[model samples]
Target chain A: MRRVAITGAGTINPLGHSVQATQQAMRDGVCGIGELDIRDVERLSIRLGGQVKGYDPDSRFNRQQLALFDRFTQFTLVAAEEAIAQSGLDFDGGLAAESGVVLGTSGGGLNTQDENYRAVYEEGKNRVHPFIVPKLMNNAAASHVSMRFNLKGPSFTVATACASSNHAMGQAFWLIRGGAAKVIVTGGSESMLCFGGVKAWEGLRVMSKDACRPFSANRNGMVQGEGAGVFVFEDYDHAKARSANILAEVVGFSMTSDAADIVMPSQDGAARAISGALKDAGINAEQVGYINAHGTGTAANDKTECAAVSNVFGHHANEVLISSTKSMHGHLIGGTGAVELLACLMALKDGVIAPTIGYQEPDPECALDVVPNEAREASVAYVLSNAFAFGGLNAVLALKKA
Target chain B: MSENVKDRVIQIIAEQAVLEPADVSMDQSLSDLGVDSMGLVEAIFAIEESFDITVPFNANEPEKSDFDISSVASVVAAVEQFVAEKSA
Candidate 1:
């Protein structure tokens, strides 16, 4: 199998709007979560979120594109532009035909859906926006990304709840490794911090009313976040031949289904994916120096994830520097793993470990070293990013230093 | 009213566990009866809806939650107390 290299990366998350800026935020342990500024915020019980503040859609897109693109799609295009620009590779002729786009988003055009639903239900409107269907479709982000970049090969979207981005990126890696596509523009975007979005989650009651403090004893719940993280995954040989700057090497990826419960995470299922990723990467547990955990600041996820890591790495689990950037960026839901991957890259490229901010006290159940409340410098050869989603879907990615 | 609440709570929990009311042991934990986290949540929802009384349950911190879910009898007792307090 061919090795896949991440040549370029970009993001517009609550932490920052670019790769450098986001990394700086991670280094400084900046918390982007605060009072949400969505419409009808007062109506929802949960008003705090990690919103992409100071973002101006008008400055990025024209009237026509704006009309066609939803907030999530716009985020994808913006992030993808940065990634493609950094990759310094143009898709044309055979390359254009072979490349594609795959993205993950739980709430595709949720802002559009919220508006139309309000228009018909609240305002009793007889008609809605004509482009609502296209804008609100789950594949809208991936389709728009493909159209923007002239990627005419295999293009699709993944919607496995929170594990969407990991699942999408894992598929992209396999496609490249299997000689299917030389390059795949892949990542995820989500912009669900709207009235209807928060209201829906309010029903589930998993949201934190205060803050997201992953692995902390007093942690309330997960906080919703919005943004996008896109990357250019290319064949390693192709990138090397072109002298492209490789950010990290995608060594291994594995996905598993718990087949157990809808929302409850299974330790066995999570451990399988974690251990499977190491085995697929052909590396032992001792080589893994860091892990970007799916620590959602919820009781079940933190403890379950810690137990799974312990089960997989044993004594090495206590040594591995594991942290949840979700404590800083909030839970991006579908787009989370994509943004969290940035932290994994930081560990490899920058030799810096992102901290799990907002940690007040440590729980014995989650007794692993969480890199609590502050960033640290560490040179690690291998890092793993874990994403365990609702519906018992698990995706784990193993990355190596470039 | 006490007897009604007990029966309703037992029936809701039994339904969630996919067991007959007679088969459900009051001393058995929800997990022992095959009620996973989602099942427990659904049972709580059902209990709340049936009695029109809110149960103070947190999915994340089930152990810390005021509503006891250690066993069927404990859940029933907690519901009965909440119901009585509501009527009082």
Candidate 2:
């Protein structure tokens, strides 16, 4: 069987615009969350968010392109550009026809939909933008990436809520490993930090007004974040042939469904997925040096994840380093796993484990070595990135040092 | 609390828990009635609509909410208070 290599990784998140900046911020344990300065801040009970600061689409995209691109699509394209550029592989002829795009997003073009809805209901307007449908569609980002990069094989978007990105990246990894495609631009992007977006999330009452402190006993809930993370998953031999810079190897991935609860996470479901990924990689739990936890800072998610980790790793639970970068960048929802995967890459390639910043008093229930609020300098071989979504969907990806 | 208000609130809670109003008891908590977190939120929404009142309940910190959901009777009392305040 063919192997997959992550040749390029890019991100435009709340922590920073580029992967380098994000890596540094994570290493320094920077808190990207703060008082959200959105359009309707006064209306939301949850005021704080990990909003992507200092980004202007006017400077990046042309007037014509801006009209067609939604906030999510724009973020995806920006990150995709960085990823494709880093990969140093020009898509032409055979490559262009084979390479594909797979992206994940829950609220695809949510900003576009929000504005149009506001115009119709609040403003009492009959007319809206012409490109609304094309811009707000779930597959818009994936289609745009494919069109921009001339990737023609299998292009689609997966929307499993928070697990979307991991599922997308896992599909990319398998596509290359199964000989369906040589390379796939796979990741996720989400821009749902708008009024309607946050307002909708507020209804669920799972948002934090102050901060996101995953694995902390005093943690309140998740803070919304907006951004994109993209990676080029290429065949190991193909990447090696071109002398490409291999960031990490995509060793294994496993997805599971609870089929039990709609919102609450299932411990058995999560444990199965975690152990399944380890089994898929054919690696022992002792070999796993780090885990980028799906720690959303909510009391339920944090405790459940800790239980699952403990169940899977047993006595080694306290040995392997684990942290949730979500505490730093906030929960990006659909795009979260893609951004968290960057932490796995960092752990494998850089040997510096990202910290789960904002950790306060640790709960006895969640008593695992959660790496706390400081980045650790640990030489790690295999690392796992976990994403457990609200719909009882879980996706775990295992990576190894390339 | 008004008898009608109490009966309506109990009915809402019972429906949320997938039980009959006769099966629901005033002393029972929402959890005792098998009303999960999502069910409670839905019940709260239904209560608001029925009584035309805004619930001050925050799912994050339920105990901190002015609207008590500890028992069926408490929820009815809270709803009646909110309804009276809205009318006043």
Candidate 3:
């Protein structure tokens, strides 16, 4: 198998609109959680969220184009634009045709589906909108991304709840490693922060009351966030041939299904995933310098994930740095892993470990070195990004300094 | 009252259902556009939600066998009738 390298990455997150801004915010230990600015919050219990500020679709797409895409697809396009630009690899020749896209999301076009349903049912309308079907499909983001850049290879969106983006990126890395595609624009985007979407999530009862304090003793639940995180993945040889601006090398990818429960997570599944990723990379547990944990700040996730990490790394668990960026950026759901991967890449390159911002009093169960509330400066060669979602889906990726 | 109701109802219907402003004339047949039974139900839901008014009668099941809900005028009249019944 060929080695895969991350040439570029981009994110439209709550902390910042771009990768550089978000990384700086992470380094400064800045938290992006704030009061909800949505139109109607009085109807919902959890009003606060990590919504991306100043995201105007009209800024990127024309009126006609905007009519065709949902907010999620619009975000995917915006993030992909930045990723392509930063990759420093022009697709003017045959490269464009060989490139593909694999995007992910849990609830594809939930807002669009809800709106269309409301329009048809409440407004006494007979004819549905022409763009409703196109907007509501799960593959809309990947299709739009591929079409925009003239990428002719395989394109699809993986839907594995919160693990969707990690699964998408993992598959993209494998495809490039297997020499199926020269480059893959892979990531996840979500904008399901509308009234209907929030109401549905409220049913889950995992929303935080105060804020998302991952690994904190007082951590209530995960805070919902909306944004996009995309990365350009190419074979090491291909990227080196073009002298592309390499960001980090994807050393290993591992994904597993717990097969036990849909909502409940398992420590064994997470440990297996971590061990499998280390084995895939031909590296031992000691080589992993940092772990971008899936600490969703929820009661079950933080404790189970911490146990899983301790099981895999043993004594090194206390020595290795672990942090949950979700504390700062809120839970991006499908986009969480993509943004977290970018954080891992930044940590590997800059040697600055991002803090688990909301960590106040650490839970005894989560006894690992969570890097606490302050960002730690340390040289890291390899970093792990983990994402475990509902339906017991687990995806882990290993990244090395390029 | 007839003109105002027709104009307001038609605009809301067109915008919600994504119909062309011109296509939502007073005489267009909604059923002809392949928007069968479910479409009618959704149209009622949107009308109620957007206008912040509940239409009279259980939209869950329709008693009328052959109500024409295709045009702007018919929908306006239906909503007005539903409104009047609730008010009475």
Candidate 4:
């Protein structure tokens, strides 16, 4: 089987608008969550969120492109451009035909849906934008990415709720490893902090009104965030042939379904995916130095995830340095795993472990190291990124330092 | 004010719990009526739509919500207060 190498990476998440900026913020323990400045803020019971503030599409794109691109799609293109530029692999002729795009997003073009819904339902308007259907569709981001980059291979979007990005990236890695595709522009993007989006989440009643402090005893619940993270996942030979700057190696991937409750998480299911990923990577529990946990700051998620880690790693659970970047960036829902992958890269490439900030009091149930409150320097050779969605979907990826 | 608050609230809760209004007891809490988290949220939405009132509820801290949900009767009283305050 061919090996997959993450040759380049980019992001425009709540913490920062680029990979360099985002990692620097992670290393400095900067929090990206604050009072949200979305439309109808007073109407939402959950006002605080990890929003990408000061974004002006007019400055970055033309009017026609802006009309066709929803906020989520715009984010995808921005991140993809950065990643492709960093990879410096010109997709021409055979390369262009062999490349593809795979992105994950739960609420694709939700901002477009919200605007059009309000126009039709609340304002009773008969007229609507012609691009509404294409713009609001779930595949809009992935499709736009293929078109923008001239990718001609298998291209699609994955929507597995919170685990969307990891699942999508796993598929991309498999496609590359199986010699199916030479290049995959893969990651995730989400813009679901709109009024309707927040209202829909509010109906679930699991959102935090104060702050997102994952694995903390005083934690309330998960907070919504918005942004995108894209990566250039290339065949190792293709990358080496071009002498591309490799970010990391996609060593292993595993996905599982609990087939249990829809909203509730299962520790057994989560533990299996973690152990399975390590097995797929041909590594032991001790090889994993850090883990970007699926800790969502809710009572059920934090303890359940901790139990899963303990179950999978056993005695090594106490030794591994685990942290939730969601503490600083809030929960990006579908786009979360993509952004959290940056933290893994930081550990592998930059020798820095991102901290779980806003961690005030530790819970006994989640009694791991957690790397609380401050970033730490560590020479991590292997790391695991975990994403457990609401619908019992679990995706875990094991990455090795390049 | 075509229907009383207690009767209407019971109807909504009964619908959420998938029980007949006759089987729903006002003294029973939402949990006692077998209204899970999703059902509880739906029941609250139904109450809001029926009474034209916002329930100021957040599931993360249900205990801290200004509107009470300790019992079916408490929910009715809270809705009645909001309705009255709306007119005032």
The candidate that wins on TM-score is 2
Worst 10 residues of 3 chain A by lDDT: A201-210
Each prediction's DockQ against the real complex: 0.40, 0.52, 0.01, 0.52
Clashes of each: 0, 0, 17, 0
Off by over 4 Å in 2: B1-4, B20-23, B51-53, B80-88
- Predicted structure with the largest lDDT when compared to the true one: 1
lDDT of 2 by residue, A166-206 (tens): 99999998899999999999999999999999988877877
Model 3: how far residue A55 lies from native, Å: 1.8
Clash number for candidate 4: 0
What tens digits encode model 1's per-residue C-alpha lDDT throughout B1-88?
Answer: 8889888998998998888988988899899999977787788889888988877776766677789888889999999999999999
Q: lDDT (CA) for every model shown?
A: 0.92, 0.91, 0.83, 0.91
**What digit string (tens of lDDT, one per residue) describes model 4 on residues A269-368?**
9999999999999999999999999989987889999999999999999999999999888888888899999999999998999999989997999999
Evaluated at residue A4, the lDDT of candidate 2 is 95
- Residue-level lDDT tens digits of model 1 in A39-75: 8998877889999998999999999898889999988
Question: Could you tell me which residue pairs clash in candidate 2?
Answer: none
Docking class of 1: acceptable
For candidate 3, lDDT tens digit of each residue in A168-198?
9999988888888989999998888888888
TM-score for candidate 2, please give it.
Answer: 0.96
TM-score of each: 0.91, 0.96, 0.81, 0.94
Which candidate order results from sorting by lDDT in descending order?
Answer: 1, 4, 2, 3
Instruction: Tell the DockQ for candidate 3.
Output: 0.01
